[model samples]
Target chain A: MYSNKYVTIYTLVMTVIVSVLLALLFSGLKPIHDANEAVFKKRDILKAIEEYLPKPLDEMSDEEVLAMFEEQIEQQVLDAEGNVIEGIKADEIDLAKEEKKPVDERKYPVFIYNSDKGKLYLVAVRGNGLWDKIWGTIAFEEDFNTIAGVSFGHVGETPGLGAEITDNPAFPAQFKGKKIFEGDKYVSVSVVKGGVKDPEHQVDAITGATITSNGVTDMLKEGLEIYLPYFESQKKS
Target chain B: MSEVATKKEGLFGKKERKMLIDPLNDNNPITVQVLGICSALAVTTLVSKALVMTIAVIFVLAFANLIVSLLRKGIPKQIRMIVQLVVIATLVTVVELTLKAVDYPIWKELSVYIGLIITNCIVMGRLEAFAMANKPWQSFLDGVGNGLGYGIILILVATAREIFGKGSFMGFQIIGPSADYLIDTTTNPWFSWYMPNNVMVLPAAALFVIGIIIWIQRSRNPKLIDIS
Candidate 1:
């Protein structure tokens, strides 16, 4: 038998009560968290290819984002061999999980944008960076080789450094119009630490963020390399 | 925290002096002590966002500290930290939910960081060291003081970074609207200062600023030079 004060019944009761309250709190906010994620994903997709969308991003609504994305775009699901994976919905493929699958088994979703110039292809890229993870949507020209626009996001990197992958506008902006394949060997866009004198391939990397710059370069090379066959076949066909 | 606030009611009214200086100089969470620097560096790129986040963090820290101090007697010593965590987490949840309801835009910008406040050492450290043994009123003051202290440094850092970084205070383009005015070296958006020392945008900058603060604080009070 125990003296209740020694047991600290009040403390125990409050603890249980607080824990339940916390459980309820987390449960209640689950929807909001999901909504925030949805918004974030929307923002990412929009930012990935926002060059085509009209400006004043604040005025743009979610419904409009979805509508613009739907009206101006068509999705193609492809297997690693560059063959169309029919009956598999591109929208249904979970991109976050898809990267984990063997490159061949993965559902590679391409957004075919019907722009004024022609069709543009957006490829999703995911890879490990020096700090944590880095991923992006690289929109390609109809040639399926030149980058039209690109946007990247990262996790747990130093701010102003690795986070420059997203926070610094220049990093993402650098990918625009950069050719991924010069002749044959994959020359994915490179991040140059100092202002790039070599205009053909490198974008000036964030100053003092060289390691992060290299991390991004590696991720781009690694993540984008797997999709080369897919793009190459498209180009040839 | 309240009890500790009243601890040495002797010289120069420590409460009065501490309240004014805790956030301003001596015990600053951002500049000097360098504890809660994550939100400061990352979010300061946008002035409005930085301001909103500053206010939210202030609110959360102050209230959470107050509640924890009030309920300190009821918390089991063995599970004291666990109790503090629960309390901080619950308040964070509440702050997050309230943001979602009230200011949706600020909510969108700051919600992720708000949840992260639970990890901010300033809140827990103050609660355990000052509030747990102190009285409620004084603990509340300590929390408010510390949060404000953190906020002041955040605002100063953010204001400096955002204005210079974007050449736009908040969203209003302080610089000329034309593309000619923007600093994009490569192409259109002119992204130079926006790209400078990405360190400025990360939490490390907070550490950098905090180092300066410690230097300033020490310089001011030769007495505080000793190991307390």
Candidate 2:
């Protein structure tokens, strides 16, 4: 058993060979892994439009999803001033990287889309929820103050509560067409409990999901707050 | 007693029942043994996704076992685990790719969960404990059975959760007014057969359902109970 000079040589050789094999295997699969990730992200974006997707997601063709998104959406990158921030694609902007720089240097990416009603604005937001990181693309109406639509996804959170803020439809849709500003006031739409009685500036918090509703409420206040200055500057112009 | 014993590779013979049924009841990896289930908790809310995950795990386990068995002799004792990981990772990659090309949408839903299968203790558990010392065929069957056992629980939990908790099966309104409600405004007004309980949709529900499954499975078959 103590043949250090004998069997040990075989162990070393085997280790090297196995390590090489692993490298080769990972290299081959890396492309597929990358492709899968890309597709998954694209699919998440498409999920925002599932109601209007015109087919069951599983049965819906990829070409159909792509065609619908392309026909409906146009991408734009804006600065904190609401002026067009050229020379950068929306997806390429890493706010975490930009956060270290001056706010003026940061480019805020926005997505513009159209339905039969009119135009919609999507602002990409990344912030802290309760447990882990939370991210979403919130759409605003042509008026620049009313919310058109919103979608959220998170790394980890209490299920049925914080997580439902992402998975539950009734929760996200509540923000639809809700005014972020109350007529010459930037009070912003609040996530009110029981029900959002104010038809103009409030969305009802999710029933049975309070902490998550609070997460959504706080995240909205904080996330949307970043764009308030830009929107205000645009209105004055 | 025999010289062939020194040369013997497969410590256990490869039989269909041993590989399949062992993990299910006699050697249940989850209930009695209690292993590998981070994903099981979340996906069990819907039968379709849970079923897909089950099949995917089965594919990974069987193939990982077979490969591990084939290479058990060649693997260096020091780096054997790393090799097993490589094989397992490769198999996971293949499964993930196949899912994307064929069923992109469900593949999307399953998302990163597919790659996480590589970390499933059940696959590694069977490969290390039985398959590594067994014949290829035997190891393959064992993987298949264990995967089935896991799937059985997932499907049961998902079916129960989706039908009762949400009132719909596979995201469709199955038990709407057309079925039994049938135009009763006051008595059967807006009856949501499936409210999609925030808890049930979450993975913790899987643990509760699995607990019930073990309780029932053991009560019916006392021998299946793990006293220890």
Best by TM-score: 2
lDDT of 1 by residue, B1-228 (tens): 334445567433667567646666666776556677666766766668777777777777778778878887766677678778878887887887767755565775576788888888888888788778877767677777888888877777776665555555666555432453444434545543343333445555655655665677778887656733
Over the stretch A1-237, how does candidate 1's per-residue lDDT look in tens digits? 335585477567767887788778778777866665565565676687777766645578767776776687788787776677778655556667977887667777777778777888877777766677778888888887778888887766665457767865766887787877777767888888657776666788876667778877887787677677778778777
Model 1 TM-score relative to the real fold: 0.75
Interface root mean square deviation per prediction = 4.9, 5.0
Q: Residue-wise lDDT of candidate 2 within A19-127, one digit each (tens)? A: 6765776677667666555556556665555554456566755566556556767766777666776676665665557667887777777666676667666777766
For model 2, the superposed segments whose C-alpha errors exceed 4 Å read A1-60, A64-72, A94-102, A229-237, B1-14, B37-39, B76-86, B93-119, B174-198, B202-204, B226-228
lDDT, model 1: 0.71
Give the Å shift of residue B56 in candidate 2. Answer: 2.9
Off by over 4 Å in 1: A1-8, A87-95, A183-211, A228-237, B1-53, B76-81, B96-116, B133-138, B160-205, B214-228
For candidate 1, please provide the TM-score of chain A on its own.
0.83
- Each prediction's total of clashing residue pairs, residues at least 3 apart in sequence or on different chains, is 15, 9
Looking at model 2 chain B, report the run of 10 residues with the lowest lDDT sum.
B1-10
Quote the lDDT for B174 in model 2. 51
What DockQ results do all the predictions give, each relative to the true complex? 0.28, 0.26
